[model samples]
Target: MSTASIPKCPMCGKPRSAEHAPFCSTRCRDRDLVKWLDDGYAIPAEPVHPFADSERDDAV
Candidate 1:
């Protein structure tokens, strides 16, 4: 078995619990949630032009 198969807690670097597969405890889990809610995490995307929809319709 590869040790790489084992998952570590994202917050504290502890071995993950089955109950919390990615986070070691509820506290870590909640912290992650709060980060998302507070915009601590973000996904980058290309900006969409407001007239892009109109241009697509004209092409069709």
Candidate 2:
């Protein structure tokens, strides 16, 4: 199997090492944790309408 190249740290934009996986260092990893705790990032989810299920009765 072929191995993919490691990705850079999202916070610092530095090359990542095997030991750190997606993060370049502990500092960068902690930075991500802090951001998560502070709600710095968000992932949007589909809004649910009150009558959406009834409108799409065929789907169920």
Candidate 3:
């Protein structure tokens, strides 16, 4: 395969390391984790009603 086709580190754009298949180094791996921990990424989701569950209660 061509080097151009090789995957790069998501955080720094460097070639990925064998030790860290998707990241070039532990730093990059940790940084990516930080992004996840800090809520830097978001998934496409349907907007949820704040009171959807409560509104369905028939007991009241």
Candidate 4:
């Protein structure tokens, strides 16, 4: 059995092969690296609420 049938890079959605499974090419891979360096992406620590936590608690 082989796992070579998958297509497209997971990061940039470009065509992928056995060689580059997650990125289509080195350029896309580097782009992701640059994004990290520039802080272009972020993961939220908690869900945002329009009202402050204290206000919500007071309302209840």
Most accurate candidate by lDDT: 3
Predicted structure 3, TM vs. truth: 0.75
Question: By descending TM-score, how would the candidates be arranged?
Answer: 3, 1, 2, 4
TM-score of each: 0.61, 0.57, 0.75, 0.51
Backbone clash pairs for candidate 4 read none
| Per-residue lDDT over 14-47 for candidate 3, one digit per residue giving the tens place of the 0 to 100 score | 9999999799999999998999999999998999
What's model 1's overall lDDT? 0.89
RMSD after Cα superposition, model 3 = 2.2
lDDT of each: 0.89, 0.80, 0.91, 0.76
Which candidate would rank higher by TM-score, 2 or 3? 3
For residues 1-60, write the lDDT of model 2, one tens digit per residue.
Answer: 223454667778777867876888988888889999999898898888988888899676
Model 4 whole-model lDDT (C-alpha atoms): 0.76
- Candidate 4 has a TM-score of 0.51
Which is better, 2 or 4, measured by TM-score?
2
